[model samples]
Every structure is written in structure tokens, then in C-alpha cells.
Target: MTPVSNGRPVTPASPGSLRRMAVTLPLVLALSACGGHVKGVMQPLDLAAEPRGNAVVDMLVATSRQPSDNPATLFSGERSALPSITDVAVSIPSGKVRAAGTVQWPKKLPPNPETDFAVVRVQPLATAQQGRDWVHRHASGGHAMVFIHGFNNTYEDSVFRFAQIVHDSGADVTPILFTWPSRAKVFDYNYDKESTNYSRTALEMTLKALVEDKNIKDITILAHSMGTWLAMESIRQMAIRDGSLPKKIENVILASPDIDVDVFSRQWSELGDRKPNFTIFVSQDDRALALSRYISGDVQRLGQINPAEEPYRTKLENAGITVVDLTKVKSTDRLNHGKFAESPQIVQLIGQRLVTGQTLTDSDIGVGDGITAIVAGTVNTVGKVAATTVATPVDLLSGNIRPLPKKKPADSGATFQSESAPLN
Candidate 1:
């Protein structure tokens, strides 16, 4: 099985991969020629565009990446010896509605079509401390959310995505992006992995600085794909060195993590029982993780695991971890891997629950439909498996752990496989 790269798969070179690319490239070109397009509306912002708009999302960024002077390029620079901070305002075209609720690049700011967004202005701070001060001053939620992007992303890609997330989720907290040096090329998975490892210490320092900040009340971390590994390792190091998890760290959310399950378990162990509330968004239908498993010659990846299946599932629940299974959730992306951040429903959930420091359970108004919420409790009996469960929100939150209905046989269940179909 060859792993095709849509710029996110972290797989090594292989003969099959070459063949897959050979087939994929022409198909992609043909689709483009016929007016097919991928990615959301949030286009890379034009550095020269007017800096103001009716709808604007101001983002604060902290990075260990080197800086780029090209107006057309934001952080196209290489890894820096030290971290840097910058602030930018993303302007949304009034009335514009993108297909995926994703931001799109408009030819101009305040685009006429009204359904678009653009990154209009970027200002580099004179010093990292100055940037932190700006974040402190502008933070409306009294807390901060640090977003770490995963494999095959450019600085612009991360910025736009973060902006879209903040806008769509309606989160009021200060947004801090911790971007590593990603080659942003489909074939540079190994390089990207190395970059993550290189950036871990810097990430730890950033977290430390946030915790030590007198104004910042709590810090919530949101990491996707490979970024989850980086985030976890940084926290683990902090715990090891400081002898406990940082008190100010409140929540840890991992979305579609691309880590080995065993490694994830080990990392969880390093945190002990004093860790922050943990939430993981997963789907058995994540095509990217499927390819990852194939490339690594491993059977299980943390993000792709069906938590209803085994000892690991019980382990997670016992720890009071919250798992939101999106296997049956509808998403605009065909890959179904990025739904944690891309799906509108999930985004709403994040805005309404996670970002505001609210608890999530199946009983929440929009939560229980096709999604499964798993938590640990006192009930020990295994319940019959069903596609959806309707437990009281109180039972879920009060630690009344019970087994979810066991899934049907493999032949009747959704198979874990790569999505080969094209996006609608």
C-alpha cells in the first residue's frame, strides 16, 4: 500500500509512494483544470493589503523559527537560535461564507463577495517580551490557548488556520501559535519530525513563561496530529525537571494525534495523577493516520484507536479522560482526519465547551447525536454496544464510569482504511 501525500502524511520514501504520487499528481492537475479546488477559503494573506476590516481576528504568535523579510512570506525563515514573537491582524471580508467555513484568501481586504477573509497586516514586535506584554494586555478571557500545528504546514498555513479556528469557534482567549520549522513539502516528513524534536525545548520555555505570568490565569493547550506528540513531550520534560505538572496549566486537548499508542501511554504515565484535564478527539475513519500506521509498520496509532475496544480504552476512561469519537460525524474533508479542527460541529463544541472552560458530555444539547463521549465512573457493567448512547450529563461528569455498548463485528463496522475518493 502506497501512502499518498496531501502534505500531511509523515511517511518515508518507498517504491509504492513514488507510484502513488505518479498517479495522484496528474489526477490533481486534471481536477484543478476542471475547477476543482482543495483547502479552505483562508488564503495566505497578502502582506501589502489594507490592515483593517469590519471583521478582524488579532493573533499573537510565538515561534522558534527564524524570521523572513519577504512581505509575501511570514515565517519562511529557518529555525532560529532563539524564540521570536509577532502579532498580526486577520481581516475577514464582510458577509463572505466559504464552503467549509474555512477562511479564504480574498484578492482584496473587505472583499466585495463578503464571504472571504484575508490576513491584511503583520507587525513584528521589537522583543519577545514585548509580544508577551501585548498578549497579556489584549487577552480578554484571562486565559490563553496555545495552538501547535502538525506536519507539512507553513507559517502562513498555521496562521490562517488559527485565525479561522478562533473566528469560527468564537473563542475569546488570546491565541498563541507555537510553530516549529516545517519544510512544508510533501516529502519532508523526516525533516519535519526532526524539527519538532528540535523545537521541544523552546516550546517548554514558552509554556514556562506563560505559567509564570502573573496576569495569565490558566493555559490550555490544543495540538493536532504530530504536534500532539511535541506538546506532550514538552510537558513531560517540564514535569520531570520541575517535579510536577505546572499548576497554571488547566486543560490539554489532543486532536487526531499521530503518535504510537504505546508511546502515548508512556507519556501519559510520566504526568502522574496531577495532570490537567485531558481531552482527545479521535476517529476510526482518519485516513491520514491509517497511512501513518502502514508507513510505520505498526497496527495502532493513538488517534485512530477505537476507545470502546480494549484494555487501553478502560485505561483512558479510568483516568477520567474525555474522548470524543467522531467516526460517524459528518465532515467537509474527505480524509476525515482533520475534523477535530475543521468540522463545524466540532468547532462549535470547542467554542461552547472547551474554550470557555465548560464540561462536555453526551447530554449537552448538540453533543450526543452521533458522537460518543467516554469517561470513567463507578459502574462496572459492560453495556450493549450501540451507535449512540444517551447517558445523563451528570452521570458522565460525576465519574459514573460504565462500559459503552460494545461495537458490532468488524465486518459490520466501519473499516479502518485510507480514503481514496476525491472530496466533494
Candidate 2:
């Protein structure tokens, strides 16, 4: 029998792999308990420099981390507060752009090794209202996509990754990042969890502020790993306080969520039928989530759950949840946990489907066979086997090869206004 994860065959763990994990697990747990160890101080790049790529991703950041004198040390969390918003100019690299991460500012266009994709400029907003207005102006068609990054991420890591997703996926809306006070260390899991919890109220405030903007049309939240917990909690808190779900939030995508099955179920219950269109990207091959499971006393992590397994598969789908298992999707990363963002095909799917507010389906690059077709097409395209071909599987996989039904526009007149003061 094939080794299975969520009813799908994954690269089976070998005796050697299991042995290695046994040796590493203890070390990781022990180190994680040690918590934050300060890393080298990061410095800001010159903002006056010209961008290498024509695309300038204006990343609006809202963070709960206490501000420090040093911008680089700004993210080391000591306490929580209302989020501060910062407008950052992330310069995308020209030519064949590889996966994006934060780099230094380039002196000229087509950044060389010295300067690559980095946060070149930042303008701080004096008030949350100012930040909301800025986002409103940038929001094409009143849509904003907020990204909540997982644990072990620095401020730079979170911002750069958001820029990469916005750029690669061709999302036309303004990109907002909710950066919690993550110690950004491999050993800081416990501290990170506490910090994430601490930031829930602040994140709720940030989303509330966005929703209050009369011009804001729709909001799409994409959270990864542990960040999913924060997102869900924030959303649930808002629903509890307001007695209804936030209407502006249209799409909620949780990828490789580092959340427990039971906890997620309760959070799901809180939505009370007013939940947004929800999508989950899970993978049995996610070693990070597998480790998370072991660390949580053998409790199954939502991201690694096999939907084909008993209880969960029916429970999730029955509640109108769409779960996509990406165990077979090839990834460039060793962990294979971030395949949702790392894979080009998946990125394209985000742009063509999710960004446009369309639901992903078999007819719309459906999972299983549809995903397989995308992987094959991507391989062929990357290999330059069909460089000149106008008709390719990529388009077919996105359901763009045939005519698609038009979607009705969201009711603009609807609002979530409340007399009660917004949560802080």
C-alpha cells in the first residue's frame, strides 16, 4: 500500500527520516524554550534611489510590535498596542525575477547583486485613519488584500513576502500586512504564540478601521501557518462584539494553518453562517505542520489534516468549507509547507481566481487532476518546451480557455457601521 496522508500518497517517510526527526525534535523543542536571541541589526535602505523594476509594491504595514529607536529593532516584541501603519515602497527586480525577499535598494534600474528587491522607502502614518485613507486611495475598486505571515518571520521577511505575493500573483488591490511581534527566531515559538495572542485585539482594530471606510468595497485576507490562528481569532472576536460578521470581508484564505482541529472548529462555529468564502490549502507533506503536531501533544494540526480521513473531511465540507490538499504539488522549498505561495501555478491561480473574487473549482483549476495539469504545464513552460505556443495548459487550467459566467457585483450599499466603539 502507498504511504498515505489525507487519503493521498505522499513521499513516504523512511526509517532514516524518522530517526533524523527523533534526533532533531528534542533539540528544536529545547531551543524553542530558550526563546529570543538577538540577531544582527538591520538598516533601512536609501529611499531616494530609483526602482529597478517598473513595479513598485506599496506595502502598507500595521504592526503591534513596540517601536524602537532603531527601525531594524522595531519588530522585537516587548508589549502590544494599537497597530501603527507604515507605507513602504518595495522595489521589484526587473527582467527574470526570481522569488522575492527583502534586499538593499539599488542605485539604478535592473538591480544587480548589490541591490535587489527591498524596501527602499517608508512613510509612516500619524494615525490609523490616515493609513486607512492611504489604503483607500490605493485600493483599485475598493479592494484590499491583507496578509498575516506565520512565525519565525522578521519585519523584512513579512513585508518582502507580501510584496512577492502581490507582485507575482498580479493582485491589483492594495496590499496590507499585519505584522505581529514575532521574535523571528527558530527557538521563539512560545514567545511568538503569546505575541500573536497579544495582537488579536489590535488586528481586529485594524480590520475594523478598514471596514469602516465607506469607500472600501471588499477585503480578502490570506494568512499562513500560525498567523491563521490570529486571523481567525480576530475575525471571531469582531463577530462576537458586533453580533454579526464583518460584511466587507469577502474572501478568507488560510494556507498551511498552524491551528488545532478542535480550536478551528470552535472558531468556525463563531462565524454563525455569516462567514466569508473560506478556502484552506493543506498538505500532508508539510513537515513543519507535522512537527507542530508533535509539539502540540500529538494533536492534529489543521494544515496537515487529510480531508479524506474520517470526521474532518465531512465536518469541514458540510460546514461549507473548501479544502484543497496540495500534498502532490511539487515545491522548490525543502519544507514544502509554503507551496501555496512558492509555486507559480498556485500563484497564478491566486491572481486569476482568488484575486478576482472567484471560487476555485475543478472547472476553475480544481484540485487533484486540475492541480496535476497545472504542474505539468508549469514544468513544460519552465523547460521552454512550448515557449512560442499561444495555447497552453496554464490558461486551460485557470478555466480561461473557455468563456466563464459573469459574477454579480457585491452590494455596495451594504455597510457594517455600529454605534459601539471599535475594539482596540
Candidate 3:
């Protein structure tokens, strides 16, 4: 009998693979407990009485999911004929009351702004012009940060997480979220993977629009897990279509990427020589990527690579990609898959350094030399005790770090087929 996963024929698993799955499946399920219970969290609340000290994150959300009929559930985890845009404001409890790098999910309906992350307002952008206007108003020094969320995420999940990141990182860029359809079920991995493929063109169009916007000077992309694949494919398509990516799109950060290692190599190679500076956050102990590796014919996943090991070390160094190895960064995240966003130090690194087009260095990381020693190795490192930051193309190992040259913008005549519209 042929093996089937999610109604699709898959290669038969080896005995060892099946044994590993038996051991890892339970942990994956336990770690994925956050999904399914929280629905309609995006429903705006009357936080008029909320205290002034609370932090509010105003984000522009673009999604390819069909709009939900319920106002609280603005978008569903299903494919849409076109992309939709909305402006959402999320309120996080003040620093005095809440810790950074944490999302305080409401224990009940009508989340209390005093403790939980709650939606304060929701507005539909009636046109692309409105989105552009929002960018102009919120963007600081023409800088924008775009976030693409990973697998098993609901619309509300993406919104709140990005809100936490923006609030914690204190990044001075306009926040935009590109959320694709994710069923938010542990067993729906295949469905979510296919959804990413389905939404690739929409993401490509969204990126092109940002590059063309006169008000946007620089853009930084942060993508996690399965979203990394989507982000890479979109950029590859853009490169193939336009000769080169716009220099304004400066930094691309991949965290816990759920991508096949071989496939990632090909994708990276296809981005052409003038690609944006790439930084990847990797952990060898990520259980999620381990499961993904098993499902993907037992091939190594990019996120679980040992950057210090052979081939990867040479390949990453040769490509001029900065790698942040987070294997020793202890986190409350049992799955060890989300250390990038869940760790306060790491998230701040994203906002304060990468978002502003600044390279990470020993002095930049407050952690002591122990962590720095690992990160300072051939592959840059950040863990519990020390942090190492590497400037691209500059060899930190050789102690020859220097500022990167200014990049000239690439000209492109590529046009996108419009697939975005305002929500009703």
C-alpha cells in the first residue's frame, strides 16, 4: 500500500524515520497547544478606559486569506481570490506590568488592556492609495519592516506576535504583516505548506509595491519557519523578473526556517549576485525542524543545521550571509523553534540593529564573552551568555570588519497583476 499524508502520496518512511516520528510527534503536539483555542481574538475591544502607559502598535496587515464573516475573525485560514489590507492597532500592557518578548493572551473574551494584548481598533484600507498613505504617515525616515509569520498561525496570532515584536524591539520602522492562509492545526502542515506556494504571487506583488513606493526608503524582512520559504521564493521571483532586487530592500532575516537544506541552497543561488544582505537564525536543537526533516524524506532542514560544521560553514561564509546560531539560548519555548522572537535579547537585536541596517558586533551585544566566543567563531553566534554579530562580507574571524559599501538601486520595468482589494 502507498503511504499517504494529508491526502497526498508521500514517500514511504524508513524504519528509523518511523521510530523518530513516534518519539517526536507527541512533543510537537504538546508544543503546538496554543492553536485552535484562541479564535476571534482579533475582534476589536472597547479599550477607551485603558491606561495611557500601555504601548499601542499600529500595523498594516496584508493577507491572501478570504475575509471571515465575523468581524472578530477578520480573516479565515482559507485561500482568497485576492489579497486584502487592514489597519489594526494592538495594545500591550505597560512595561511595568508585563515582561518583554511575551504575548499576554487574554484569558477570556474582551481582553483587559491592563494585562492582555488586545485589539484597540481595526480599519480597512479602502484602496492601495490608503496603504501608501499609512506608510507615509507611520514610516520613520522612510524605513519599513515587513513580517511574514510561520506555520500554524491564525490571523490574530500573527498580529499579536508582530505587535509584541514591534513593541519589544522598539524598532523605528513602519510595521507591515504579510500573513498567508494557515489552518492553525498541527496536522495540517502539508495544507499550510501548499498555501504558502499558493500565496507566493500575492507576496511578490506586495513586495514590489513596497519597493515602488516613493515614501519607503529602506525595507527589512523578518520571516520565520515556513514563511521563510515563501519569502525566499517571492524574492527569487522578483529577481528573475527584474534582473536584480532593489537596493532599498536592505536586510532579509530568516528565523527557524522550515526549509530543505538542499532546496535553500538552490534558492539562495538563484537570488543573483546583487541580493540583499541575508541573516539567518539557526538552532541545531529545534524539534519542529527535526520533524520537518523527517517528513521531507529525512533530508536536513536549514534551520537545524550546525553552522560551525563543514560544508555549511564554508558555504555560508562564501555567500557572505551572516548566521546567528542560537542553540544554547535557553528559552521558555519548549519546542525551541521560536527562540528568535521569544528571547528578549534576540528580538531587540532585530529591531535595534538589523532593522536599522546596522551590523551586530561584540560591543553591541551586552552578553558576556562566553556567548560571544561561540558567536565570534567562523559562524556568528548568540546564545544565553554571549552574543556575536557579524557584518556581511566582512570576515569577523579575520578581525577585518569594515562598513559595507552603499548599494545602488536597481531599475526594473516589471509589473504585477493586481490581486489586492479593500475589505468590505
lDDT of each: 0.68, 0.68, 0.78
Pairs with backbone N, CA or C atoms under 3 Å apart (clashes), candidate 2: 6-306, 362-366
Candidate 2 residue runs with Cα over 4 Å from true position:
1-44, 47-52, 97-115, 366-424
Task: Give each model's clash number.
Answer: 17, 2, 3
Q: After superposition, how far is residue 177 of candidate 1 from its true place, in Å?
A: 1.0
Worst 10 residues of 2 by lDDT: 390-399
Candidate 3: count the clashes: 3
| Local accuracy of candidate 3 as per-residue lDDT tens digits, 1-424 | 9878899999988998688879777767765775545568888887547687998899999999999888988999999978999999998999887888888888888788888899998999989999999888897878889999999899999999899999999899899999999988888899999999999999988888888998899999999999999999999888867766878888899999998876776676455456576788888889888878877788788888777776566546555567788888887777888888987888888998888777666565544511221232221222111112222223222223344432433553322111121111
lDDT of 1 by residue, 132-169 (tens): 78877877867788999987677877887888887777
Model 3 sits at a Cα RMSD from the real structure of 9.9
Q: What is residue 411's positional error in candidate 1, in angstroms?
A: 49
Which segments of candidate 3 are over 4 A away from where they belong?
Answer: 1-18, 365-424
For each candidate, give its TM-score against the true structure: 0.75, 0.75, 0.83
Best by TM-score: 3
**Where does candidate 1 stray beyond 4 Å?**
1-53, 107-113, 365-369, 377-424
lDDT, candidate 2, 59-173, per-residue tens: 7899998776576545555555656778877666764545432233344543343336655667789986788678767878777888999987777677767877888787777
